[model samples]
Each structure stands twice: as structure tokens, then as C-alpha cells.
Target: MARAPVLAAGGIVLRRQATPLIAVVRLRKRNEWVLPKGKLDDGETPRAAAEREVLEETGHEVSVHEFLGTLVYDSGGRCKVVHYWRMEAGDEPAYELMYDIKAVDWLPLEDALDRLSREHERAFLENVGPIALKAAALDGAARRKAAKPATRRPRRTVAPPPSVSEPDTVPAQFDAQVTQEEPRSTTEAAEPAISAPAAAESQIPPSFASDIEPVVIDAVPMRPSHASRRNLIQRVRDWLRRAA
Candidate 1:
């Protein structure tokens, strides 16, 4: 008898704070509150397969930020190990219309803890909670780092305010400015408006109208010739002579 190959996958149930902590779907159909997961497909790494399965099973978009932990279990006498990861779900599920997901709902973290059925589920909740919190703290520190403005050298002393007497010279400057502006404005006024030109007229000749419009021709009736009438009378006369 051949030994069965060990099957492996990964899952992460998410919980957000609310009246009830919102954890990911507990699939009643699958009988597990598993983060969407499946066996590693041929040529696919365990971690990549885990992420792909989660996205397929749950319509939610998720990014795998870090590896969480692993769970060992059994299915049909085969040993299975599931390696988990912490991923953030996008606000909207990218694959909701896909058929694999029967349904999804968010439950409170506490409620999820109380309701989760698997032993691995308990372990994951415990292990991942602290890791996630730590990850969150690290994220906070990074954000703080980003928010801190870079140290800038003291700005060079600003030049003293322009003299108040400059306003009296405005008339002289305005005359020169208007003389420069008038010709440019007049030239700009001569530019064309930016609408599409009307369509060109069709180039077809008037003689081609007969092809365009359907034309009906009357049929001429057939007429018998004078020779045929004479031949008929001669045949009748020959028949009378033969009878006599």
C-alpha cells in the first residue's frame, strides 16, 4: 500500500473591534471558520497557494504581510499541515461574484473565540492576536517616523519689505505693460474656434441614382406571327381535300 502524501494549506480568520469583533466567514458548508485555504496545487508554493485559496474562497482582497503559524490536522486518514499568514483584507471583496464562496460575514473577535470549533483555531487566535498587535505597534512607529518632518536649515533672512514709495511708480510700469499686452491680445482674438468641421458632401454622380433607388421594369407580352396563322389555315384546307 502506498502512503498518502501530506496535504498542506493556510488560513487566517480576521477580527475587527465592534459591538462584536468581526472575524471572517465561518463556512457552515465546510464546517470550519477557516481563513479560506486549500491543498497546495502542483508547482505552487504552500504560502502562495494559501493566499490564492483565501482570495478565491472569500471574495475579500487580502495581502499576506507575514507568516503567522501552522496547524496540523487529519482528513480521511491523511496527515495535513496548514501554514498560516497575517493578511489585510481590502475594504471591498474583489471576487464576490465567484462561485466558491457560499457566504461571508464578520463576527466579533470575542464571539469568534467563543464560537470557533477547531483546536488549531484556538491556537491561531491566541498566537496571531499578539503578533498582530505587535505588527500594529511596529506600523505605528513607522508612521510616526514618516510623519516627522525632515530637519531643514534655518531659512536665509528674507529681504527687507519693498519700499512703500514703489506704488507711485505703478503708472510708468502699467503704460509699458499695456503697450506690450495689446498686440498679443489682438492676435489671440484672431485664432479660430475649436469645433469639428461639418462632414463633406457625398461624391456620387446623379446617374448612379438609378442604382440607389429600386427601379421596376414592365414585362412585354408574347405575340404569334402571321406565318403561323397562314400555316393553320392551309392544314385545315388539306384535311377537307383529303375527306372529299
Candidate 2:
């Protein structure tokens, strides 16, 4: 029986530095430029498959911030669903990407659209362009928000402190319950686990046990031919051994 055409996931990974750069791959023999795509394995979700395929085909670790729906196209009488995602290249490029692709080029948006293989692929790129751009914008906005200092709340000023009321002690039962539920000490509370450098150093040994004398074992023999040893000589040897 013929194997099913794989359900694939891919993307037109876009990066906007000075200009929008759409990552494209050039196939081997034909040398046609197209977006990264690959087969989705069993048990792997569409989004995960898309990200993994992109990373494998082109060495770029990306965050799938948005999904660009699915595309269906026929290949050899089988229907394949390709889940698309808008990915952003992290701080640095994953690795110098090279593949069956003759060359991996980052083309300008217009150039990418014009150079893409099919109308459907072009439409996919167009659909994802806005999402990628939006992600970039949101990233910029977050950075700006982080950089700007937070405005401090105004301190309340009382002209004269009002006469303090007598401390109304709570009931014994209530106090006992509250004490039981609440943390016994500062250490037990949800305060930050801030440790002194000296304390941290003291807690961790200078050298770990594994680091000192690491266990190393030789691998066992695993030859396929070891299974059939029923020759006459072997049988005779086995008989002799059994007799001994």
C-alpha cells in the first residue's frame, strides 16, 4: 500500500531589521525558491511541527506568536493539510542555515512575493506579513515599556496623626486559627529566597561526586550474525561442554 502524503507545517519567517527580510529556500535540482515546510509526524501538534520543520529546514529558532490557518493542496491523490505559523527569529540566528536548498536567502517583502513558487504560497506570505509585522510592533512596544521608569505613587501626608485607638485583641480561637494557617517564621513566608553569595557557596560542595569519578562502562556487542551458531563444529563443542 502507498504511504499517505504527510500533513506538513511551514512558514514565511519574516524579520524586520532595516527592511523586511523573508527567509526563503532554493531547492536542489530545480533551484526554486520557496518557504520552509516539512512533514508533521504522528503525535506532534501542528504548531509544534511547523516550528520544528522551520528550524530543521532553516537553522532559525523561532517563537510561534501567531497561527496563519491551514492550507490544503493535493499531491498524488492524497490531501495534505499544512499548518502555517508566523515565526520570529530570536536574538541571534539559530545556526548558519544550509540544506537541500542551494542557498538560503533573506529577500525583501516585494521580492519575496514576486519570487515565491505558487499563488497559494504568495497568499500565505501575504497573510502572515501583517501578523509578523504586528509581533515586531508588540515586541518594540514591550521594550519601550520596560525601558521607561515606573511612576511612583504619591505618599499620603497627615497634618496631625489622629489619636491612636486601643489595640482590640482578637478572640483566642481566631488567633490560634490564624497562627496555624499563617507562616510560623519569616523563612516559611513567600518572601524572595535571597541568599548571600557566601551561603550559596557553603551549601554547594566545591566539586560534585559525579564530577570527581564519573562512571564509564563499555557497550555490549550487538552483531546480528551472533544469533545463528548451529554449525556441526559448534554443536560438537556444545555436546563436549555438556558432557564435561
Candidate 3:
């Protein structure tokens, strides 16, 4: 009867930089450098196992992304199948390295491939390294674009209020008619008459008429003159004579 394959999971963990770096861990017992990976725990999914294993081996918290590829090979006469995912590490490590791991190295793709002890793992990285680096570079660019502040719109210039024009000048003839008062002679008893020009000047245009106030006369009692008193007495005497 054929035995079932040993299930394992891991990550192609990257530290983002100008040029992204990959992580490879050195084993304590075997003293061999290999990709950070481990066997899946009971009831754990491949993705969860990959994230946990990479964190333990690299000591850095990571953000898991899309699935990479799977590796199937013979390990101690047993079929071992390992699943991988793309992951990004934070700037610093969050935990100590696992007891089984001696050290973790962050290296370029070529160096990581060359440093890896297993042939299958090296070949896998070489196949997928460029893909991971390209994705990381593109992701960095997108993040920078999103983080950039938006350009401000220029302020609109408000025009100043229009200047008030000088009030319309009253014609010289109209001014004379308004301000000049004719002097009356003591012997002249007749009321002053308005001339035609004065009447025409009084008919001010509607635009200027709005500024003029109407003249008002108050009703007042006047004392009778000597001539008026003499006329009244004569009228009274004539009426008395007629009655008699």
C-alpha cells in the first residue's frame, strides 16, 4: 500500500525596499539554509500554516497575499508536498526565531536561490522570484500613488465692487430757481407770480425729482391790517342804516 504525502506550507516572504528581498532560514539541527516552511498542524489550513510558519521562522509579522506554487518531492522515502504563498514582512521582527531555526537571512533573489541548500527549493525560487519582485514593485508604486496628497485648486479672485458715480449735477438754471428769492418792494401789494421759465424749471426730471421734498404750508391766523379794519366798520355802519 502507498503512503499518503506529508502536507507542509510556507511563504515566499518579501521585505519591501528599493529592491525587494527574500527570506531564507538556516536549520539548527541540519545546519542547512532553506525556505521558511513547516508541516501543517491538525485542523489548520495551508494558508494559515504558511503564515504561522513564516512568522516563527523569520520572527517577523507578515501580510499574506496570493498563492504562489506547490513543491512535491521525496523526503526520507516519504512524499512531501509543500504549498507556498506570497507574503510581505514588516520593518522589524515581532518575535524571536524558532528554536529549530538558527538564523534568518534577507537576501536578493539570486543570493537567496544560491544560498538555499535544497535543489528543489532553489529551482522553485528561481522560477518564481521575478514574479514576486515585479508584484512587489508594482504594489509599492500603487501605495505611493495612494498616499500622495491631492493638488489644491487655485482660489477664485473676486472683483471689487463698482465705484459709486458722482451724483447728477442740477442745471445752473434749476439751481438759480431753487436758491434765488425775489425781493418784494414795500409799496407793491400784489402777490408774486411764477414766470414760464420758473414753471419749466419746477418740472424737474423724475431722476432728480426723487431728491426734492414737497413744500408744505401751515394754516395760521393773521392780525387784521388798519385798511381791513376800516372796511369792516364801514360795512357794519351801512347795514345799520338800512335796518333803521
lDDT of each: 0.61, 0.71, 0.85
User: How well is each residue in 1-244 modelled by candidate 2, as lDDT tens digits?
Assistant: 8666668998768765767677888778777878888887889887888888888767778877677777787766887778787777654566765557666777777788888877777887787776777777787789889999999999989699665886578789989999888855777553344333334435655455234442233444546676454343354454334333
The sequence of per-residue lDDT tens digits that candidate 1 reaches over residues 24-93 is 5556567665555777888989888877777777777666767877777676787778777776665566
**Preferred candidate (TM-score higher): 2 or 3:** 3
Off by over 4 Å in 2: 1-5, 96-98, 153-244
Ten contiguous residues minimizing lDDT sum, candidate 1:
193-202
> Taking the candidates one at a time, how many backbone clashes does each contain?
7, 0, 0
Sorted by TM-score, highest first, which candidate order results?
Answer: 3, 2, 1
Name the better of 2 and 3 by lDDT.
3
* Backbone clash total, candidate 1: 7
Worst 10 residues of 2 by lDDT: 209-218
1 against 2, candidate with superior lDDT: 2
**How well does each candidate superpose onto the true structure, as a TM-score?**
0.53, 0.56, 0.64
lDDT of 2 at 106: 79
Candidate that would win on TM-score:
3
